[model samples]
Target: MTADTAVLPTLLTALRLPSIARNWKRIAEIADRDDWPAARLLATLLEIEVADRTSRRIQRHRDQSGLPAGKTFATFDFNVATGVRKNHLLALGTGDGWIETGDNLLIFGESGTGKSHAVAAIGDALIDAGRRVLFTRTTDMVQRLQSARRDLALAATLDKLDKYDLIILDDLSYVRKDQAETSVLFELISHRYERHSIAITANQPFSAWGDVFPDPAMTVASIDRLVHHATIIEMNGESYRKRVAVARVKGKDSASDN
Candidate 1:
């Protein structure tokens, strides 16, 4: 209500401290009522501003990440996906050192075995931990890269992607064995090798990747680079979707009988 208080908002806006600008008045009332020290009040405001900025940054990263919603680790069923260790994933979720060192994460499993969900969950964790991540279908990313190549902007596009701490390519096996498409994919893998992290979900083993990369030699090189410094997780189990479908049918039958 004072002249000084009326000018506080404008000053905060000029300083670009939106969080502090918005909450400072309410917090100051609490500080005064509680008889807090000057240092405590200042520290509290700074902490609120930092936390608000961090939340906004994470939200922005999540929006740009293209990650599927509701696929976070909290919702993942570790019991069904028995091959994946909860402890190991929890450790990886921290993204403590591997992401910094550009280590790759390769997940291999059959369709509907929760590979995509698992990786997406890990990606979500990395984002929460202040790491930037991009989630895209393997084929979609390859098509974009191919277009970039044709436009003579392939290098620039790759350079732009380097900003992300990790790129999650879902369903590697779905990419057709076309030379052009596969060539662009190979180029992406080669470019990011040892420079950035890539987390890939695949339905096929390395031996079957010859069908993904038309050139056997290219396949070999790609595999070598990906596995050189990677944590390979093999998810082997019945399809989660299949089980859910069966359960739905049983529930319907039981309801009809009742």
Candidate 2:
């Protein structure tokens, strides 16, 4: 029995995280009496369980290019736990319990209304619940689609969107998409419409989607499908970055006086 073999049982009990505890063998190998850095790093890494969980999330979205590393709705103020529900904003978007039933959703708000964060949090929750999720910016997705097309895998790539439980397109309208890209995007949205779920964070309103897709008909079709069984969440607030900047400035001034 090696030293790790001896403490494996106890270490498992320490964190009470069975999934992480399973890594005891490796953790023990690097945990030497003098290697505090290595030991602490390993411990902290496993303790968060992010190492294990994030991989699963990434794998799920690898097909659809799902959620970001650790985004979730729980991190924001409008969490369902204590959020104010105003379907008026999302009325056109929400389609009969879709939000609660893993259907599509769209969050359109000006800079810093917590729109992206809220949806990201939801994506995180989906991951935690063992649901497939992928998060990417519109520009990133279009680029990815373009790459897949070059490899002659565009159809395969769009189909993958159906595999994911949820997909989040963050910051749409960053740039215009060509006809082919818009076609693939439309297919992707149509595939997820009423079938899977999607959450989009856009700085620009839907009225301006035409700028992204020069084809007027395609844009309307895509939006129609996306909003059909979806919920639209509109948030209007000051920039979060600006608020943080103000707070930091106040702290600096206070320090100078002391």
Best-performing candidate as measured by TM-score: 1
Candidate 1 residues 1-258, lDDT tens each?
A: 999999999999999999999899899999999999999999999999999999999999999999999999999999999579998998888898799988999999989999999999999999999999999999899889989999999999999999999999999998878647668888888999998999999988888999898788999999999999899999998999999999999999999999
How do the residues 7-120 of candidate 2 rate in per-residue lDDT, one tens digit apiece?
A: 866877796666666665565555654465765857664665776666755565444544554444334554321222533323322233554455667787777667666776
lDDT of 1 at 174: 87
**Local error of candidate 2 at residue 155 (angstroms):** 1.3
- Residue-level error in angstroms, candidate 2, position 191: 2.7
lDDT of 1 at 133: 97
Candidate 1, residue 194: the lDDT equals 93
Count clashing residue pairs per candidate. Answer: 0, 15
Weakest 10 consecutive residues of candidate 1 by summed lDDT: 176-185
Question: Each model's RMSD to truth, in Å?
Answer: 1.2, 9.9
Task: Tell me how candidate 1 scores on lDDT.
Answer: 0.93
How does candidate 1 fare on TM-score?
A: 0.96
Q: Candidate 1: lDDT of 90?
A: 81
lDDT of 1 at 123: 93
